[model samples]
Target chain A: GAGVSQTPSNKVTEKGKYVELRCDPISGHTALYWYRQSLGQGPEFLIYFQGTGAADDSGLPNDRFFAVRPEGSVSTLKIQRTERGDSAVYLCASSLQGHNEQFFGPGTRLTVL
Target chain B: AQSVTQPDIHITVSEGASLELRCNYSYGATPYLFWYVQSPGQGLQLLLKYFSGDTLVQGIKGFEAEFKRSQSSFNLRKPSVHWSDAAEYFCAVGVSGLWNKLVFGAGTILRVKS
Candidate 1:
């Protein structure tokens, strides 16, 4: 009965550092997604995983961004050499297969200073 | 490339007054539409969605949306506005069922006045 959750409600790091953000999806969910929301802007799609494989990564801004869902229940978003531009609220969501409504988790605010 | 647009950047309405937030989308085919509300420092909450059948859909908190295919729009409306209803509203279009990439509008900020 647990909902999606993300670790590190807030993270502050220097530019060019590497950071990893974790997400625990709801039990039995087969699809996971990551989105980024900048100040005063709507969330932008980052990546999506169907099961353990990333069904779509086109939303990743660049090669520096990567995500993985190894066990099909948890996902980690990786940012390499983070730039100040990467600072934003990272949100995670999960949904049942073939279901349109997605359950979202409280976002992890990442600040690259 | 599917996209969503919310023409109104912000709207303020008196409590108990009728309210409407316009949303327009551009997609190639029959697209899945959604409305979400996000409070400050909170994650998005689904208000309603339109995938088929009915042109009008009902959602939580007395919210409803009408999907007009001919206009490529799905406008959210409520007969009476409440102060708690003030929040950011997003209109999104699901690109496809397989990937389920949602293209969201910039968002419309609603303000309620008593």
Candidate 2:
């Protein structure tokens, strides 16, 4: 029905400012993903899409990061100067394009103070 | 350098007993295993996957996994365990066509003693 969805579940910027994290992929899902979880560590990969382009952003770790889904469902993920190490928690996933068994969403906990 | 090795970071078991969680991976060819389960804010929840014939895979709720290619491994099991099943248990390794990254590990909390 409706699964993958991410908004501002939680965010607190301050370091340098500039943040945008959004994702809503599920309906028909053309493949999309973005992961990052610090704290104890686990999720890591950081960019991927299959419909509006961005097949992969090579784990975007530097360059301030950037993401866009154009018209392939919905995706935002954009960070410019924010850094406290960029905080953590920022996941989004979707699948059904071949195999990957993805389907996650309920993240967006960035806090850079 | 694909990798994933969750050699237990925490494990308590005792809500009903019987449970194993260990995974190891080093991709280079056939490998797409998975097993996710987070509950502390919630998000990932796919309990099982093995992308091939029957290497013993059964996900969701009861949970089950066993895809041992010699020694690469793919543990995760469950026989009872119920205190709401504790939480945090991840071990992934997926990378299919197009650039679908997913190499995860460093997880495995599950602590349900009582």
Candidate 3:
């Protein structure tokens, strides 16, 4: 059985550029979540998806951040006009429905220079 | 809003010494508490969780946590820490609802001295 996986383990981009981080959740997981971790800080929730629809997105910082899980197995977090402040490690997690435990991925570090 | 607090910014303990990491959370009603460890370049790993029944919960890697409602705390403890135990520990509270949304603390860095 495979665990959660994220692509582009590390990404560096200029300010005002766009970047997309991909997450492949474990097989049969019905819930997905995205979090951001800054230096010297813990991870903060960004968005969450239940199945193909986003159940809660209040944690998204702004409109520039968006995520989609079209097929219910993979998710992509898109950032538009990235800013230096947006630089951080983007983490992806998945869990079985009705389960409290969340399995996290290795994360994609996004650097906005 | 539910929140978590990890007062200790950093802790250093000998490999054979006892270890305890304090965690306090603020949430209404019965809260779902969790302890997670994050190693360098690795994803977050769950250490233990407390929901109901016994206040003392045992978890993987010889780790355990005690939930004290009076103190609103769930502190992680281990009898003897190993050098490989050095990492960042996070205390999180899960908001009980249709989806379990986690609210995490600032985290405490643990250093194991051999």
Candidate 4:
């Protein structure tokens, strides 16, 4: 892909439901990131991946929020027992290497109702 | 931990007027600063970034930013505002040792009046 791409542009799920958001980063990029943005606020860092390993998951809100970049290209963010507070736009970004400028995706808007 | 602060929650500027958005950050060492713009229903677009050397950096779309190490600030400026420039602006700071995980400010909403 020319840029980072996220799937299921929007998702609405009931409370306590599980959801998975997908992200496909640009080819050859070694770094990927996930962020969550609430209305009227800036995007908050959620997780970061370097190659096939998660370099940083400190930003994930809790254990329920898990992300995996198995092949170092495509990544998945899975949430368990969703809550209304979890409703937000999930963004994905990719960069050629660590500490480099990142290219962002259109983002997936997840609504927990 | 690195963090960014965009003091102005909302700003309104008339078309053709000069524009300046303030940003401050807290970082332990030489910080990598960035500015991004987001229009409604759109993804974030990097305006400019400051890594090393020049304190003043020029970005795309007629945007520029100046990094002040003393004040711990990196402010975005445009010579003239356009109605099309109305959007949300975010200031971010990245830790030098961290692996590109950026900490972003709350964001400033710009409303350009024609």
Candidate 5:
């Protein structure tokens, strides 16, 4: 009955640091996705995972961003050498297979100073 | 590339008044459209979705949306709005040929006045 959950609801870090955002998808959900929302803008696709493997990573901005969902339940998005430009709310969502509707979690807002 | 447009950046309506929010999307094939509402410090909540079948789809909180292919629009409407309904609304299209990756428009901020 629990929805998707993200840890560290808010994180603040200095530029050039590393941070990791975690997402725990709903039980029995086979698909997971990550998105980023900047100020005054809508959320943009980042990456997606199906089961334990990432089905699509094209939306990842660069190599500095990476995610893993080993065991197919929990996912962690890792950012290397963060930049001020990376400041934004990171959202995670999950859905049942074959369904178009995605249930989103209260995103983790990452701030780089 | 799939895209969505929310023509209005902001709209204000009196509580208990009818409301309509416009959404237009561009895609090559049949589109999976959706409306989501986001309140401050909260996650996006799905209001409704139009995948197929009937053009008019009903969703949570007494919200409904009509899909018009000819107009390339899927506008959200409600007969009466409550003050608590004030928030940001987003129009999104699920990218075709991919796994339900959504393309969202710059949201419309809804303000409700008593």
Candidate 6:
């Protein structure tokens, strides 16, 4: 893809339901990241992947939030037992390498009702 | 741990006026600093970055940021503001070492008045 792309531009889920957001990074990019942006706030880091494996998951918030990038290109963020507080924009970004400039996707606006 | 702080939550400026946005960060070593802008319903776009060398770094959209090591500040400045510059701005700090995550500030919203 020419830029980072995210699926389901908007998602609305009920409490206790599970939701999945997908992200497809730029071609040949080796670093991918997931971030969550709440209303009136900047995007918060959730996880980072250097390749097929997650290099940092410290920012996942809790056990309910998980992400995977099995092929280092496409990534998925899964939230289990979603709550109303989970409503926010889920953003995906990719960089040619770590600590470099990141190109962001359009983002998935997740609303948990 | 590294963290960024953008003190002003919101700023209103008239078009063609000069603008400055303050940013401060807490980090142990040399910091990789960045400024990003986000328009309504859009993702963030990098405005400028400061890796090393000169204290002043130039970025896109006629924006520039100066890194003050002693002050722990990386303030963004523009000589003239445009109506198109109305957006949310974020300051981020990355570790100097290889392959580290970026810690971002809460963000500052800019409103341009015609």
Q: Model 6 off-target regions past 4 Å?
A: B96-99
Per-candidate DockQ values are 0.59, 0.31, 0.65, 0.72, 0.65, 0.66
Q: Over 4 Å off in model 4, which ranges?
A: B97-99
What lDDT is reached at residue B72 by model 1?
A: 94
Collision count for each candidate, in order: 0, 0, 0, 0, 0, 0
The global C-alpha lDDT for each of the candidates, from Candidate 1 onward, is: 0.91, 0.88, 0.93, 0.92, 0.93, 0.91
> Chain A TM-scores, all candidates?
0.97, 0.33, 0.98, 0.98, 0.97, 0.97
Between candidates 2 and 3, the one scoring higher on DockQ is 3
Number of the predicted model whose TM-score against the real structure is largest = 3
Which candidate ranks first by DockQ, i.e. highest?
4
lDDT of 6 by residue, B66-101 (tens): 999999999999999999999999999985444357
RMSD, candidate 5, Å: 1.1
Which pairs clash in model 3? none
> For each prediction, how big is the interface RMSD?
2.2, 7.8, 2.0, 1.5, 1.9, 1.9
Task: Write out fnat for all predictions, comma-separated.
Answer: 0.51, 0.76, 0.62, 0.71, 0.67, 0.64
Candidate 4 lDDT by residue in tens digits, B42-113? 889999988889999999999999999999999999999989999999999886545478889999999998
**Residue B30 CA displacement from its true place in model 6, Å:** 1.1
Candidate 1 lDDT for residue A38: 90
What's the CA RMSD of model 3 in angstroms?
Answer: 1.1
Q: Is candidate 3 or candidate 6 better by TM-score?
A: 3
Clash pairs (backbone) in predicted model 4: none
* Tens-digit lDDT track of model 2 for B7-106: 8899998999989999998887788888889999889888888878999999889889999899989999999999998999989888651237888998
Provide the TM-score for each candidate, comma-separated. Answer: 0.96, 0.34, 0.97, 0.96, 0.97, 0.96
Task: Report the TM-score of candidate 1, chain B only.
Answer: 0.96
Q: Which tens-of-lDDT digit does each residue in A1-113 have in candidate 1? A: 88888999999999999999999998998999999999877889989889999988999999999999999989999999999999999999999863547888989999999
Clashing pairs in 5: none
Off by over 4 Å in 5: B97-99
- Compared with the true structure, what per-residue lDDT tens digits does model 3 show for residues A21-74? 999999999999999999888899988888999988999999999999999989
